[model samples]
Target: MPVPTRKRSPFLTLLPWPERKALAEALRTETVGGLVLLAAAVIALVWANSPWSHSYETVRETHFGISALGLNLSVGHWTSDGLLTLFFLVAGVELKRELVVGELRTPAAAALPVVAAVCGMIVPAVLYVVVAGGGGGSLEGWAVPMATDIAFALAVLAVISTSLPSALRAFLLTLAVVDDLGAIFVIAVFFTSDLNILALLGALAGLVVFYILQRKRVRGWWWYVPLGVVTWGLMYNGGIHATVAGVAMGLILRATADDGTDGRKAEAMSPGDRTAHLLRPYSAAIAVPLFALFAAGVSVSLASLGDVFTRPEPLGVVLGLVVGKTLGIFCGTYLAARFTRARLNPDLSWADVFALSVLAGIGFTVALLIGELAFPDGAVAGHVKAAVLCGSLISAALAALLLKRRDRVYRRLCEVENRDDDADGIPDVYQQGQGEAK
Candidate 1:
């Protein structure tokens, strides 16, 4: 008997091969992710500030979910809380990978990025407080500018510098990873409300169970999915943000199986790597963009822009991202190198570090999320969002100019290194220098 083939979805079948290929590639590329995020944010801003602005607000505030279980929330809240959990889960997996085998495995390798990330967070916070101190806005927003959006920064660098070395990219990725982990901690600690001790303990109990299951080599997704949902629900009930549950789930998954035997015929992938691979595209392309669309739709006008200048909060955020971020990262990296006697890779330079430091100022995702958490349903929240957009834009433009200059230098270096006489592949200077050494 012949078996029937499963019917393909119209969505997949309708798309052209080239378009699907481009989308698959784009989902894997940080540059494309950043562009999509930017496009979403821009579209949101235009819609919010346009003639149909009230309609945008109405849609954002529309209620959804089952009210009986206290699951109902505004559209924006669902995006921020429900959708962003996926992103955080992926982040958790990445954090585990870095800790287990990546650049963060060794203290010596992790020192510079850790120090830079710490300083990068601290200086901006201090600057925010200083600029907005004693002002009309609350100081609760100190953490708003403390994040570095890795996707945006990498996108900028990728566009402007094709010859940029991988070492530099690795450094930036490490710093952002640390920065994001810190931001998660801050959210769980500082932003939670009406904490329930019993529910929190339940959440902990669930986490312990999840960890034990992984230790026992529980490999099926069917077993873990329900556990994750129950944990998330318990976390939300405990007055903790549901997103923290995702992070918890991510950290507990085994980077390597506990058993010594490499049963590859049965065990195909590590838990963390498999989970990340399954979820990263969804988190990047769907969850993040939806979050951006909802979080970024702030109505802006000339009057509001004028008012932002007057308010300490907006100015503080702008300066925090544009100036504080650059200063903090550069000084921190410089100090780490000075004290530890750690040498930078030969392909990198102080100028390159400085340029990348400025790019780190693009604090979009976490910054906007924190702004909403800090001043929910307040006028200042809108201003904070606007300031985040403006600040990130300025940083991207400045980094582009700086990186362009550096790109020229790298191109010349590449050309010189590739220069060959007598139609030989090797450069003449290299051959001549080798002859002398011999």
Candidate 2:
């Protein structure tokens, strides 16, 4: 008797090799990046609490930049304001792809996550206000918990829930994109100081030119890099966060080439996709971890950790991130399914959704950004940063516990779905599902 041979799944075989490689490489990069980011955060925490804590503070406060250009900022500010743009640029590219060709392309498919993201933002802000008593100087920090660090959340998922459905990752990515957008809007509207209209107009003009070049299929880092720097510089000078320029550049680039193409596959390989593919690794592995190293280094002695719970602002941040995020995301998703045509994937249960929601509460990167902006004074900022770390840690622990408990079910489902019982290689389960969908 001849032995049965194993082959690729029909879905995997259908995709181009380069696309498949890129997808696989991206997942690996993000998983590795998440690990690196965690290590960086841990180092920062240790350094901040060590006997040499003053050295950490001194390094963070050291200034470096062109003072003539009004660009001199501390080490921490540079991390938060400058390096973080790369992260947002990748996010912008991802958001554009989702809007154009990915899960968010349709109204119904997009509605659930978008609504969930909105509620996720709103509820956290409301909770912050209520907990912190948003009257005197406390309301500024309300936006701190409204962010979900995509790298960190995805990292956690990659570590523990490898067998989970792809839709959950899609949902999380979409949620993070919308969450970042909300944070950007909040920063631009509320946190900006000394707006310079002329510089803003210049940034707009630069974006227009960049868009035109992208339409002409202008390739090479030489052309885009200089233009990107100019745009970022202008936006920074214009009193808008420099990171917004990153998003603008990402969004302006066409997701699909305008070659009068009819096929979906051809259009899928756009400048945006290529840019994201090339830049995502650096954004995840280097830029983000460095930023975390600089931004997350706050002295969290036992006393400060205790104070974080008692202080109104830090208390609000904790509640907003841990409780408000889970409540808001779960309720929003449930409401979307209940009222709209949108429904959860059959492979996912409400338990899975709740776990994902808790995972979304890991608001590390942008949460730190907002906390810095909200309380620029170093005295209080440290406590708030401690709160963010605490809250995010709690959320991650809960999410991991819940997801691990359900790993058996997901593993069984994965094996069943990928089971190729027939002598021929393709999984009958997937073929049948696709047939039913069609």
Candidate 3:
């Protein structure tokens, strides 16, 4: 007799137990953070439009930081430039894990999301340029709509999806992580200020020292924490976004537990894992939400709302996020699977993939940040922020509708699957009827 063989699912195979556990924990934290971020954005919008709008402006303008380090910035700038680093750091950790040990460890597994994410970004920028680049309209905001807010997307998924396969969640998270990396690269490459060579070199030196400490297995918060601040300040002064510093540090840290280099016992967790675990709650609950509070305080009115559609730049943002993101991701995934060795998961249909692509359109946090970077002037920036809010809200609503419908289908399938006429315990309806017939 021949031995029985097991077949595997295509594209996204079930992750190992350890990886699944890690992914689950990260998703939960991000979901809660998404809710908090939403709340903060809501408060900001309300306060900015309310009778106390002047007070809101005052608070956002208040400045305080280490003056000697060239760190003093307005509250709004601090939130965008400083607190947002925590969010990016968490993003960096997620990328490190996925690349090193998670779904992205293999090229086949990574290709699906990677292809989709790349298309997702390119289409948005192309669409933005098409819509906004007419009559020498500035192409500065081309990259604004290229990100997916992981927290908000995951949070919306949690609410709408039940009984869906875990693979779907993993796929979405991986795609968003790739999307985030692209956004970070755009920020680093395109949105820089005048270069300060000395400050940039100093920042690079600090990163080298930080990397060395990690390699030497130096484990002390006191030693690295201050160094991190110095590095961030230098990077900020060095004409690059300070958030780059956080990601740089995160990537430099080891993602896997290692044997003791010196005469010491091996630790159970790697420094990267330990830091991500310790900081994720703060990043999700406090850092991101606080940033959203300051960043999302765009005043809303009939004129501002109308400008989102009438103005070329803001209009481009809206169309890029909603239309471009949906088509790019769906089409790109199909192309990859068709041309390459990748295959669609047996558990998912094209409709489900379409819905997932639509969900990727919620580019809340990073879109607004890029909007500020692109349109620094007050009036245009305000309009662009409004456009981001509008685009994300529209995407969320569409995704929610599609996801809820799919969740119901999956729920029905689950019921049929679990209904067993032959089980020993509490017989199914079929068995009860058959017994009566007998």
RMSD of each: 4.4, 9.3, 12.9
Better of 1 and 2 by lDDT: 1
199 Cα displacement, candidate 2 (Å): 1.0
lDDT of 2 by residue, 1-438 (tens): 999899757863557889857765764465777888899999899998899989988998999996545688888878887888988888888788888988789987888889889999999889999988842336778899999988999889888866777778888888888888888889888989799999999999999989888866677789989888888888999989889999888887778655556543344467887788777777776778888998898876778988888888898999999999999999999998998898877767898889989998999999998898889886778888998999999999999998887787888866775665455577787678889999
* Candidate 3 residue lDDT tens string, 155-235: 999877777777788889999999999999999999999999999999999999999999888998998999999999999
lDDT of each: 0.86, 0.85, 0.89
Give the poorly placed runs of model 1, Cα more than 4 Å off.
1-22, 67-69, 134-136, 256-268, 420-438
Model 2 per-residue lDDT at 114: 91
- Name the top lDDT candidate: 3
Which candidate, 1 or 3, would have the higher TM-score against the true structure?
Answer: 1
Angstrom error of the Cα, residue 257, model 3: value is 1.4
lDDT (Cα, tens digit) per residue for candidate 1, span 1-438? 899999867873558889866776677678887888889898899899899989988999999885533587889988898888888888888888889889899888888888989999999999999989957667988999999987788888778868877888888889999999999998999999999999889889999999999877767898898888778878888988889988888888867544546753354668898888777677778888889999999878898887667789988999999999999999999988988866566778999999989999999998999888888878888999999988898999999999889888888877777764546877777889999999
TM, every model: 0.91, 0.86, 0.89
Of 1 and 3, the candidate ranking higher by lDDT: 3
Which residue pairs collide in model 1, if any? none
Query: Which of the two candidates, 1 or 2, achieves a greater TM-score against the reference?
Result: 1
Question: For candidate 3, which ten residues in a row score worst on lDDT?
Answer: 420-429
